[model samples]
Target chain A: MSGIQYLFPEYEVVRNDDRCIRCRVCERQCANEVHCYDEGRDKMFSDESKCVNCQRCVSLCPTRALKIVKSDCRLRENANWDSDTIREIYKQAGSGGVLLSSMGNPKPLPVYWDKILINASQVTNPSIDPLREPMETRVFLGKKPEKIVRGEDGRLVTDLPPQLELSLPVMFSAMSYGSISYNAHASLARAAAELGTCYNTGEGGLHEDFYPYGPHTIVQVASGRFGVHEDYLEAGAAIEIKMGQGAKPGIGGHLPGAKVGPDVSRTRMIPEGSDAISPAPHHDIYSIEDLRQLVWSLKEATGHRKPVIVKVAAVHNIAAIASGIARSGADILAIDGFRGGTGAAPTRIRDNVGIPVELALAAVDQRLRDEGIRSQVSLVVGGSIRSSADVVKAVALGADACYIATAAVLALGCHLCRTCQSGKCNWGIATQRPDLVKRLNPDIGSERLINLLTAWKHEIKELMGGMGINSIEALRGNRKMLRGVGLNETELRILGIAHAGE
Target chain B: MKRVYVNEEWCLGCHLCEYNCAFANSGARDMVSALKGKPLVSRIRVEGDGRITYAVSCRHCTDPLCVTCCISGALRREDGVVRIDRGKCVGCLTCVLVCPYGAVAPGPDGAALKCELCLQNSCGAPACAAGCPNRAIVYEEREEERS
Candidate 1:
């Protein structure tokens, strides 16, 4: 084990000697200790083996003299057994542990959003200018009455269920405090408040410092129920029951003891330096009735003033499962697809477990309408909504809103290095270390997040205006404005859209 | 007057500000040719313990002690900026000793060196403040303290 080396360094740190001024800025900024100065040689050198390709050194280099590139050296190529497959086998043989990865799945799977083309008004209908006229992007998520009800006096009943309102149909999904840093959560909370949107507190109870932003918070309850209290339950505008996540659908979550620092432990109500592991499934929820009881319990605890959301992974029978949740008194259903992001997950389970969100969203919407219970629950789909176009496509396929975590963290300076499991995030969004966490100032992070969402809001308005739809409510479930470019008959039928030529 | 201020909370202590200052004042074509294999004499320096850090430079106080103590007339207060005239400096080291913030230092040619907010350089503004990645060093004007 000590003599043989099974793997080679994947990335090479290229430093231009002529351009490097020996400022040593890269050496100081990297948390991985990849770069160091050899005082005797009067030069700087990098240890490529420790480099994660996170681009921290390259970004902070004062002279722009550093670049990271994938090593060109490779093993003999085979069509069926690629280099990555062979490397994974060697790694497992040596370590005897499951491969862990961070962020979303990187496989080249089918992306329905890319295949779907949007329509525009031609010579007949006129397109509205968003700058000149009013374009309503606001949406309210909650159950709606099937028909107008009248009291004994024949007057219209105006009372409706509690709802979660948003300036735009996009939200920052659940990335818990224990999984990310305090500054990341601070940035999200401030940005959500500024944008008139909501951010989910993924199973990590609400931090006391974020209580002022409660109106823009969604507290989540998972199988472990890490920090469930009366104050914690009341600290958010809505509650989410996280039955499963998109990444590692059938497995549970585990935050290593090293990351369970005092702040994270206090926030999660766990002892310091102890691992926080969530069970695979809720112990009390074996059937739909059990789900209904929990939903009602949360609603009752909140005094029936806040909406309840049930989040589940998009799987084979998602349409039927959504039907059960809709009838279980849950006001909102959040479906996480296969490509969702996570702080840590088994590589195999993350790569191959759940179904694509586009098909799941379409099937559930159609099934709920067929069952005449579509009005009882609102649908929100998440996994990898990358841009405004994805959000627009999701709404056209009957999603009330879209949840985005990877894109949100990217806005806060994540390079998508896919090495968050190591917990030494150089960019500061995923690490709990005080030095690394301080790298992300909430002032800059919040401003950047606000800028990203504000830009997306304008793009959404433009896309809606191009379709001659001035309001988001008018674009909801409007499949007539969508066409499939490379979809087969079954996919086109499932998506309920016509072929591009037709 | 606009002045450079430091907020210790966000300082990353990466020393990029010091490098930017040296390069901006070097007057060379680029940072590589100016600072390569050279001992840096940056006008701004960062002072920190392990846990906390902050950049220090000329404060340009209302009544500067360095300006009063310069016997060779090298240090002068011009439009609220305490600037050093390297040509007239006598290398007495009086200003370096008199500066309370320890910002005044001797240059390579035995002249007193201090921060002029980059006004004398091609930058036309403070490079240390501009190059700060975390906005820890800022150049702005705020309400004066009554005391």
Candidate 2:
């Protein structure tokens, strides 16, 4: 034991003695083992230090007796050296390891989606009633033909390039098989199938059970190429080359050996109990030319029937990077913003690196337009697309579609406690342990996801109807429909939107 | 007829169904007032080891053994639900022994008690299925052969 304790427990578990029935449900449900019943005292107690405030015990408490609150305990209040900062320093000193975190960045930063406001039609233009009028939310992601051509017979040619059709402009983004549990993956796959959209398989290989959902899947090949195979490439409507993730932009992924169970190992084609380390960069890809080779190889491998997507993090030169990827023979370009969620990442890189997706999307869209290659590829922006409003805003800013992972997992029962590195997720969304994995029943999980997307589909229609837009295609890249509030001139210029009331 | 069924695969074994069943049938306005600091006499009970668990209650069979064996004529099948009349129960312990599922047990009043699908209680539906966190227990009509 340490001679002196330097840190205080962050949370206090409050149990109402009157309401508690001593059922001990909290004691059994908590994976952290924070709650215990003292048989001698005939009462329940909690070790608050171990509590992650996941609300598992509170949700399961039959009598509504438990509540977790932040402790008021402080250490010489100083804004310059906040309590969390000091505690983090102490933690690093004690453990001598890099600070790791999960989920999206919690730091207070500018959320452009919140600052941007959508325009609504008033007396001048009649807003269509979505309930009575026909509205189209369907979107297709792929390259559009530069010009129309006719055959020798003078009949108009209808053949177009391969495209991934989505009933709505939203998709369940990549959260690999190994990163999330099998039940979680099953839920996403089933929901995507039922919703007529797609879910990315991340860098992890596709599970055999999900093969029937290939039409609603987007197989990925990242740095490690963990599950990349001929059958795997052919099993999806599209393939994404994961150049970098928004969280920890310049680094790679590290799935600890402990989470690599036998099923995860088989799906990822890796040995059980072995750390799955994806290198920082794909050794074969260094320039746009190299990227073009891989794109063409994947296309050739798939009989040139599937569209290939190139995904990159929003960095300093994201516009130039997007331009290069568009010319690299990629059919779709996916840009992930700084506020993206991750299974596990170094806290330093997650909190520090990368640019916001709004600015990146606007910049890339304008750059492609100026280069006369706007139709060369489709643009999909991800990294914290929290709601239908965010989807509408992203589309107006020139995104063909939106990718959402954090929001999808939230529907599948993720509380975002930001402790995924520990792999003790009580919700069963992030862990591979059999007991926790079974906690998420695919039947309930899939139903919830379907409900979320269905609701969003309605909201997206209503928002578009208010804007006097009937289809998502007309809303795509229509920057005039958006205006910024409380944003500086530079911010407004970068986002390519006027100030509100202009 | 709609019957409460257990999937077992998704059952968390937290025994929340048992608590919900007890509280729903307790006839109190709230759970704290209903079953606090007292032994839980739940109509629906969860039975299993740590690996597997499922809630067990009356199956409401077409030919119930408890209804046929009730010596005091307390147990009866009403609208396909195996119900009991506590006023007529003699507490002979015969229903407890004849029941194959062990779903019947003596209540705190020394009367045989079993699940009546919450029809007699304030809850319009089975509380065990309604309170199940993982959808492990579902009250729905299925093919008799499948049940």
Candidate 3:
């Protein structure tokens, strides 16, 4: 059978003769069969083709004599219709086999920055200078409910729901410890506390080390319900019932045993690897009533202290589904659009399954308002809420707050190569490998995340101030202050905003 | 005879091989606690610009000079695999200065360590190849492109 080359061209281990100390560390430490000892030659012979560029031998040599560089190779290039560089390499190597990779979207698509122009305050309404004015960045996420009346004893308290109090509108989305690493979870937990918001412990149960950040954590209960005991239920201020995710809407995730070490297995309540599969749909939740039962069960289990959030992917019929969710007794409704992040997922589902958050949020908001149930529950949208502008746009479309994952990672120095499913994060934010995990300094990661959110919060405050709004509460559903620049009549109608220059 | 090969296109650039390489070389008992939230020191690396990524590690070549470059005889090729002797390593990083692939790295104890193909602990295979989710990096007796 024809196959890729069995061996690369032999590379010479070049050394600076001026720097040679005759240290034997390189011969003793190399893992590949690259180095050879020839007693007759009285010198070590190096085969360069075998070197992997790990830099292990280089760092270990006391005499500093080792250096591994890539051998010179040329590629045939035809810019006219050649596939991607990776695809071409695979074609050359795998004989034209379909190349597979793990985690998030890799394709370059159109970013809506220029398409969605930001409305600035001009002569009509003066923009409030954040330096001089009190710009409120506070946001509440949960059911607003109806009717808060005074009791017979004259103390104000009737029937208002629980909400997540945020000093800023942005939050850390659900990224499991098992999916990333224990240190990754710790960094998120600490940053959440520092930012006065919440970091989610995804389907992976809360690690014991993070229980102290209970006040700033959102514990998720997916269909698998891994490590979801009564304690895990009560450990967070809010409970998010993950119905589906944008990355793989109709599919569940499987953390292979090779990646699931002892700690991840214990925390997730699954055998080490063993194909931890979370089915596409909740077997028990067959109907709206069934969803209501689960929602009430969680609230009852936590004595109503924690608000229950129903997290659903933004599918085509999201408006109707959201209307049902609003009536299902959930305190918050979190909709994930198609472009969400995941540790691993099928390629087809990530790019094709769910709808855009913009459309879904607008539709859901319109439906709930039309049904007079807008006050029943709060809304949170995820699946690539990229920047402060996206957050503001979501709020204009009736989202209370936004859940950010990729942005959070970017803050922590993630280049968004989308290889998270491989479980080896070069930056050490993801992956379970002890050595790779150490690459991420949690103190630095947490502080960087805090900085990102802090800066975004200030930007959000400035945006709100320009609209003549002092608080996020005032901006909620206040679409009159927004004017669409490039949107069509339908887009403007759906967004509940007037056309520009109207 | 021992070698490492990467299926570049299949490589997701996740860097799991790097972590696995680092952990396998760390000599730590608890993998999770050792790796959690720490800066990485892996013997292998995922190489690529933003648009393309692939795992790059030691290939364990037929004729090796890293062994010849070691003045202390700390690096040796036994049978078909390259092995590092930490006891004699003075942490002078001489092998690092010579190898073309940049494969040699420092150990946790400041000694020289490279991909030993997971032979020391007899994990049966290289940890990076075993742990890679995409099967991008593979360890075998010969580098044959499998269809």
lDDT of 2 by residue, A1-502 (tens): 4777777899999999999998889998898999999989899999999999888999899888999999998899998999989999988888899999999888898899999999999999989899999999999999999988899999888888899999999998888988999999999999999999999999989999999999999999999999889999999999999999999898999999999988889989999999999999999999999999999999999988999999999999999999999999999999999999999999989999998999999999999999999999999999999999999999999999999999999998888888877888899989898888989999999999999999999999999999999999999999999999999999999899999989
Looking at candidate 3 chain A, the ten consecutive residues that score lowest on lDDT are: A109-118
Best by DockQ: 2
What would the per-residue lDDT of candidate 2 be over residues B30-146, giving only the tens digit for each residue? 999988988999988888898888889988888998999989998998888888999999999799999989989889999988999998899989999999999999999988843
Write one digit per residue (lDDT tens) for candidate 1, span B1-147.
899999988999999999999999999988988899899989999999957989999988888999999999989999989998899999999999989999999999999899999998999999999999988999999776321
Rank candidates, DockQ, best first.
2, 1, 3
lDDT of 3 by residue, A1-502 (tens): 5555644543446664444433344654444556666657546677776564445456544335667665554345677544455444654475544333344555564333224444667888887888798988888787774666787899987565787998877788998887887767888899999989999999989888889999999999998888899999899989999998877787777777777788888888888866677888888999999999999999999999888999999898999999999999998999988778888776656766787777788899999999999888999989888888888877877889889987887777666656666665655676787645654567667888888888888888888877777788877766676667777787777667777788
- Of candidate 1 chain A, the 10-residue stretch with the lowest lDDT total is A1-10
DockQ of each: 0.81, 0.84, 0.02
What CAPRI-style quality would you assign to candidate 3?
A: incorrect
Q: Compute the lDDT of residue A265 as modeled in candidate 3.
A: 87
- Residue A259 accuracy (lDDT) in model 3: 75
Write candidate 1's Cα lDDT for A1-502 as tens digits.
Answer: 7588889899999999999988888998898999999999999999998999999889989889999999998999898898989999999999999999999989999999999999999889999889999999999999998999999999999999999999999999999998999999999999999999999999878888998999999999999898889898898999999999998798889999999988889989999999999999999999999999999999999999999999999999999999999999999999999999999999999999999999999999999999999999999999999999999999999999999999999999999999999999999999989989999989999999999999999999999999999999999999998999989999999999999989
lDDT of each: 0.94, 0.93, 0.75
Kindly indicate the candidate among 1 and 3 with the higher TM-score: 1
